[model samples]
Target: MQPTKRFDAIIVGARCAGAAAAMLMARQGMRVLALERGAYGSDTLSTHALMRGAVLLLARWGVLQRLVEAGTPAIRRVTFHYGAEAIPVDLSPGDGVDALYAPRRALLDSALVDAAWEAGAEIRHHHTVTALRHDQTGRVAGVVALDEAGREHAIAADLVVGADGAGSAVARLAGANVQEEAGHAATCLFGYFRGLPDTGTHWHYAPGAGAGRIPTNAGRHVVFVSVPQARFKAELRGDRLAALRRMLREDFPDLAETLGDARPDGELLAFAGRKGFLRQAAGPGWALIGDAGYFKDPITAHGITDALRDAALLADVATEGTPAAFVRFATRRDDLSLPLFRVTDEIAGYAWTLEEAKALHLKLNGAMKREFAALTAEVVS
Candidate 1:
């Protein structure tokens, strides 16, 4: 059925990136439609740690307060443990941010969706985009979607955005090229635990495995253990939780000890494959944001921040629908993303000795400094 309604933009995926883009464009008084394949306020797989950059963007979007109100605590320090040595880095919060946060995805994504609605974006949950609608000249016109009732809707828009995730349907429909990819390296298992004793985030790294403890809401901490693919396969053969316990005890005894009194709040979630890809960000009347356009291994815990940053960047130029604007957006996204992508790929490989890990850690810090410096320079220019 041909729909009578059209929007300035139709964004697929109502999660962090899509909602942020919708909110930004609607703030400019553009009519926007956001579609999600899942229910509103539901959760997805995430480490749930918010870096300073993401926190800054949330504050700018006026949604950080909502997350804080949702019971997310402030994280002030990040500690990296390499065997007996502990390196702690204190985060200096300025501007509107007092500290970092790792809110549950339910809280964080729901807040962003609310912000999008408040900005006048129409959001439809449980609606999946099945195909892209194209013009005779071969430009993307919009999307064909399926609602909860299994009814088909022909939603037309000036631009279509694929924020659906790494395996993005919009990208497939738009024929976006995979500019680069870092193949799978490691796997991760994570869960929330009650009685975890910390307000800050901690990371312990060993030769082929690593663990992260990040404090989140409701006095629960999100803990994850990452191992090389080989170890992950050998260990996760049967009884997954028991396998995780064994991995932690054998490779990360200190982290295992820290969880002695804590019990898991739910089943442990496993992510056995990790890859990073950079796809074409914009082409014709279609553009991509978040994971659809760029993805990095989660070992660096930069996914959320990168999504937020690119949403803002893409929103600034995408509404125009000009080829020049799309190229500009793609350029800026690459400039901001490539450095961290390289660093994350290296770290996610999990192929380093203790001394090598320490060296790479320092290198990562340097790369972060350079990235921020470039961003600052861009703002000045």
Candidate 2:
């Protein structure tokens, strides 16, 4: 690709959203350029539990077949826990969509990006977008990024996408509204553990606390412990494990075993990663997808799955929209993403309540259980 040359789209942030959008657009015969501020998979702090719905996208991209061959764990059941006991809920990948897997995002991110290249998207890593260059009419035109040498380079495109995430520059440029309406997200932190059972997954819910322990490809697992964000103290952030243990034992006792003997590999996963929900997905000549557009509680581990579906929809927009696709893409995102955001917020909030917490166990109705599992499965495959 030539410098200052125009492309069908210029995407910022090459992780999940940008990478998927780039590949999807490229595969659709669009000249796509993806820019990443960080090295492909280095310095990332994610639990890497690729959801079942995301697995479907990888399968469609043929990477799932490769992952299976690579020894990544394929999970087929979910384990729900309250107190000391856990129950496994069986779900099939009928219609060819299996359960879920944890491929170590550090490793899996590279695979997705590489697939983008195979599909013909030009990936430019370590290239951070400094600013968005818009036309006089306030239409997004491209981005100006700084390279390793500190030189300024401009990459122009018809559509400018901001997948930069959380603190999105493109979103700021487009005047996208973030949900400031008392998010009240539960506090959470998770990491990979090497000795947990992988035969089935686990969901341990307790009053104002809970943990989701997922079995990976090997004997490895990733455990997520969520608590009320209000309890997080300035000092607790200084000691992640101690803080984590408190949330586990005091808040949710159901996850004791999974939480016990689990030593963290690093300091902490995220001290304040209450998910962000974007208000828009596209504009006149700009678009946002995946986390750039909407995010749900990773308590369900829906980040990557959101990226997959957003990619599919954006790909269609890139092709059929033939310039008008941006409108339809944004509209579709506006229509589909809000309901998900509202419901997940309710679900996350309930986990922080003792009343709802008690009902998460055997008392949970068939409707709640079915909807819960079905939604998680949908986000994954």
Candidate 3:
């Protein structure tokens, strides 16, 4: 059926990247539609840590205050543990950002969705895209989606954005190629806990394992462990929680001691590990953002930040509504993303010794600094 209504752009996912893009575009007075497959404000598996760049964007877009008002803890300092030596860094006030945060996905994604809706974007929750519709010229012009009631609707738009995630259906439908993929992957097992001491963010690194304790909303901390995928599969078998506990006791004994009697608030979650990739960013009337375009292992915990960064970049050009502008968006996105991607891949490899891991982290820090600088200059200017 032909679409009875049209939009300037239709976003395939309404999480971080898609919702942020829709909000930006709609704020600029473009007609936007965002389709989400999940229930409104539903939670998803995520480390959910926001880097400085992401915080800057959220602040600029007027969404950070909502997160703050929702009682998300402010992360003012971060400690790096290298074989029992702790190096704590206090975040100084700069770039209009005083502190960082780790809001739950339920809160962060819903906040962006609400912001988009308030900015005049049409948001459809529990809507799954079934197929892509193309114009006669073979460029993606719209999509056909199944609503919550199982009714199908064809929607026309000038562009279709793939922000569904690493397993993005829109990217697959659009034949977005995998441009680059990491050779190594790490499995991450994490869970939330209450009553743990809130000490900002703590990252512990040993020879071949990594763990972190991140403070989030409701006075809970997310503690996670990352190990080589092969070891996780061969050693852990089906008992992830036990393995996580053992690792915490053996590799991160200090953190385990701090855990004291703080039992898990929820079930343990696992990302079994998949090779991270950078996919084709844009082609014709379809474009990819967030994990749909570039995904790295959760070991780095920079996924959401990258998603917000690319969403802004894509929206800046996508509003122009032309193929050349999309190409420009891709180029700019790559210029900003490639360095951090390389460092993250190396860290995710889990092939480093304690000293090597420290060096890699330094490199990662440098990359993040450069990213923050670039985003501040461009977005704030």
Whose lDDT is greatest here? 3
- Residue 72 of candidate 2: its Cα lDDT? 82
The lDDT, on a scale of 0 to 1, for candidate 1 is 0.85
- Residue 132's lDDT in candidate 3: 95
Query: Candidate 1, which ten residues in sequence have the lowest lDDT sum?
Result: 372-381
Highest-TM-score candidate = 3
lDDT of 2 by residue, 1-381 (tens): 235888988888888778877877888899989988888776465556675556767777777776677688777787666555556678755546766777776666777788889989999888878777778988778888998787899788888888887677778877876643326576677766676656666777766555777765456677677766665544265677776776777756656555577675566675464655655677777777766667666555566766766777777767555556677666656555555555556666754454455443333233333433444454322
Clashing pairs in 1: none
Candidate 2 global TM-score: 0.86
- lDDT per residue, candidate 3, 119-199, as tens digits? 999999999998999999999999999999999999999999999989999999999998888888899888898888888
Mind sharing the TM-score for model 3?
0.98
Q: Kindly list the per-residue Cα lDDT of model 1 for residues 1-381, writing each as its tens digit.
A: 886498989999999999999999899888999999999999999878887678877887789999888889888888999976888988875655579899999998989999999999999999999999988999989899999999999988999999999999999989999898885567899888888777489999988888889999899988889987887878887676787778788878888888884668768889977588999998988989998899888888888887888888878886567899889989988877887887778888877888998888788777666654544345310
Sort the candidates on TM-score, descending order: 3, 1, 2
- Candidate 2, 81: how far from true, in Å? 1.9
What's the TM-score of every candidate structure?
0.96, 0.86, 0.98
**Which of 1 and 2 is ahead in TM-score?**
1
- Pitting candidate 1 against candidate 3, the one with the higher lDDT is 3
Residue-level lDDT for 379 in candidate 1: 35
* lDDT, candidates in the order shown: 0.85, 0.68, 0.90
Q: Over the full model, what C-alpha lDDT does candidate 3 score relative to the true structure?
A: 0.90
Give candidate 1's total backbone clashes. Answer: 0
Query: What is the Å distance of residue 32 in model 3 from its true position?
Result: 0.6
